[model samples]
Target: MSLKYAVLAALLEGEASGYELSKVFDVSLANFWPATPQQLYRELERLAGDGLIEARTVPQERRPTKRMFSLTAAGREQLAAFAAEPTRRPTAVRDEFLIKMQAMDGVDPRAVRALVEERRAWALGKLARYERVRERLLDGRTEEEYLRDADRVGPYLTLLAGITFERDNARWCERVLTVLGERRAAAGPAGPAALG
Candidate 1:
């Protein structure tokens, strides 16, 4: 999906300045749709020109004025239309790590292990953050209760997806590390060459 749709969906919660929206993207939308601050700012300008979003400048005493943005009526209609469209199957992931894995025969096992370990740490950190966000969404309620009673389910559902993806990533990384560690151990002081 385009960044425009992501911006519109974020505005559904309420009006926010570009900075606030950037934070929103980082915290919530980063899971599925990532955007840089510059990209978001440019999109905001285009959205305003297209009349999909309206912006009002807020005067500040000691700082540059900030423009707060809200979705226009047309924006809501556009978002609704987009939502009604048929979903497309996600394309296969294209990642550098996958390429490295495929070329592992020519690469150093220690290097591969290091990369995988870093990824594992990152995935674990992201999973922990996602869990905290999930808890916040759930508040004091159970999952079923939250699902039934929350004002909007979209964010929670997306958070669940992020959680699942990170969990799987962590598991895959752990498995890779285990296999590499065993290979290294079996190869002894001569290293991978000994195994070959």
Candidate 2:
């Protein structure tokens, strides 16, 4: 999907400045549709130009004026039509880390293990961040309450997918580390060459 749709969907939350939208993308959409602040700002301008969104300049007492954006009726219609489209491309995995893992046999096992360990830590950190977001989204409500009564549940559902993905990633990394450790142990003091 284009960044246009992502911006439109984010505006569904309500009116926000470009800076605010960047933060929203970082906390929420970073998992699936990562965008730099510059990209978002440019998309916002394009969206406004296309009449898909409306922007109003808001004056501040002590700061420069900022433009707040909201989805126009046309933007909503566009988003709805895009959502109704029947076909979507399947997700493809294109990770550099996976490529390195594939070439692990030719590299130092110690180096590969360090990379895997780093990945696991990163995944765990993401999982923790996602959990915090989930809590904040839920507020004081239980999961059942939030899911049943919240006006928008798409964010919550997507957050769940992200949590699951990170959990699975961390688990897979642990398993890989275990297997590599075993192989290294078997290879003994002679090092990775002994494995051959």
Best by TM-score: 2
Off by over 4 Å in 2: 194-196
Kindly give the number of clashing pairs for every candidate: 0, 0
lDDT tens digits, residues 1-196, model 1? 4788999999998999899989888876888888889989999999999999999999999999999999999999999999898866563465787787887776788778888989889889989988988898898899999999889999899999989998999999999889888877887867877323
Writing each residue's lDDT as its tens digit, candidate 2 over 1-196 gives 4788989988888999999989988877887787889999999999999999999999999999999999999999999999788757776667899999888887878788899999999999989999999999999999999999999999899999999999999999999999998988888867667333
Clash total of candidate 2: 0
True-structure RMSD, every candidate: 2.1, 1.9
All candidates' TM-scores?
A: 0.90, 0.91
Model 2: residue 56 alpha-carbon error in angstroms: 1.2
Look at candidate 2 and give me any clashing residue pairs. none
